[model samples]
Target: MSTSSNSIARMWRTVLPRRGSVARASDRFQAGLLIFVALLALAALPVSAAIGSETYVRQQGESAQQVSERSQVAATLLADGPDITVNSRAGVVGNSRLTDAAWLLPDGTRRVGKVVAGQGRLKGETLTVWVDRTGSPVDPPLRGAGVVIDAVVLGLGLWLGALALLALGYRLAVFSLDRFRFAQWQHEWFHQLDRKTRS
Candidate 1:
């Protein structure tokens, strides 16, 4: 049999009951299975890490490209936003409000949109808003080490979770084997005691 098949056979042999004899095969099988699962999980960690690192690099590059492509333009608030006094006692609730505003594009064309601003902003107050080349508002993208950190965190979390699960499975398997053995021993001891008492 192949190595994997042999290992499986060995594990199965340990779990199967033996007639008229004590069976310790299950313990061996549990131990062997635990080792196998541990090794397999360990092997997967590197692959996951590599994939995560690659994802980080890709995201970092994309963010940098966005940084280069996106531009911040000063847009004026066309009118006062929602009243700040509405929730003053409750501590600033939804401090930003959308108000109509206008700004000049790089091509000297006027662009008007609803820009977010402070609740009590006066008319023509300058607010910095990010925009893409088409003058459409966009959120700033993460860059540099931020992408790297996020990727590492995600990768490590998944890898650790996988390892932990494998270990837990191994523990449960071992516990099951121990329980079976204890039951078997108890049965034998009771049978012997009964015979001795009858003699």
Candidate 2:
């Protein structure tokens, strides 16, 4: 199995573009590590979201944005269409027959509507909005899956970093012990050499 795997790896090396082989391998390893980390973070995202903390706050914000957009579109459409007598609140105040366009804000109610560019007055059928201050929903919304992805990625990085640190620490400890052993061996050798010279 090992031989076959080695042969396959050699085959891949031959097939791949000839550049700096070491660099290419390092780059590939780095890319693989990054992908691994991302997957882990993704898995962790859900757990974080489940806490119903900042995640919930952000979700609510997105929802509000979606609602607001819908409301704006509704208002704009109200002026665009003919008055619906069946629905009293559906249509606006003036005949929003928009041939030209203009803006109006004589009162605190700032509005732009169909009016001649040079014309003084602005006019648009003011339709009664049943829901006021309604915010827009978060389109392309983030869900649990997204949350999970985020968490998994974060977790993966932490895990990898920890593993790396452990490996490094182990290497350092081994190196220190080896150096101490070598010093002791060298001291003993020196003493024997001196005794032999005296003899």
Candidate 3:
């Protein structure tokens, strides 16, 4: 069995093309794939990065922090809601507020409320809650959504390119085959024609 396996393996190697050719093809495909990926990555990267960076300072992380800190301070400062006033200059709302903020109720134990901030405008006053610690996190864990879109776009490009390349490469690879077949047919046909002419 081992002898047969060895013989078959040797035969396979003898019949197969050079290993270097396969490696070269793999390298070419890798280079092409990198180009395809870089285009998408370049477009998505900046937009997504800008959004996250802005959100950290302006929206998600900071808003919560400020509100929480102030709320803690407010609870300690005034005692009740009738006179509790957060001012205009405090700036942004929503998730950007500080994380750790809880109210000290009159009794003793800590009570939790949203970071309470009122936006001040020249016209009027608008109060906003920057952080709702009550709710679950807004960020999702695993994503299967835009990936499908990207895959479809990238896949279509790859498939179409592959088809065109195959068509071209097939013409390249089989030029010799076409010529060999044509030569064989021409030789046989001419031999018959010559015989007929002589007779």
CA lDDT of 77 in candidate 2?
A: 26
Tell me the TM-score of model 3: 0.24
Cα distance off (Å), candidate 2, residue 92: 46
Model 1 misplacement above 4 A: 1-23, 81-97, 118-123
Task: State TM-scores per candidate.
Answer: 0.71, 0.34, 0.24
User: What does the lDDT read for residue 167 in candidate 1?
Assistant: 82
* Best candidate (score: TM-score): 1
lDDT of 1 at 2: 100
lDDT (tens digit, per residue) of candidate 3 on 1-199: 7997895554444444366544333334433544454455555545555544443434444445544543212222111223324557864432223232344433455545434332222112223322224331222222234334444555455555555665565455457555766787799999999999999
- Root-mean-square deviation per candidate: 7.8, 17.2, 17.3
Q: Any runs in candidate 3 off by more than 4 Å, and if so which? A: 1-148, 172-176, 197-199
- Ranking according to TM-score, highest score first: 1, 2, 3
Candidate 1 accuracy as lDDT: 0.82
lDDT of 2 by residue, 69-165 (tens): 4332222222334342343776434433333222222233534333211212223433323222323211234455665555555555555565566
lDDT scores of the candidates, listed in order? 0.82, 0.47, 0.44
lDDT tens per residue, model 1, 73-181: 8898888877775555777666777789888888888899988877778897898888899998778767777898889988898898888888888888878888998
Candidate 1: pairs in clash:
14-25, 14-26
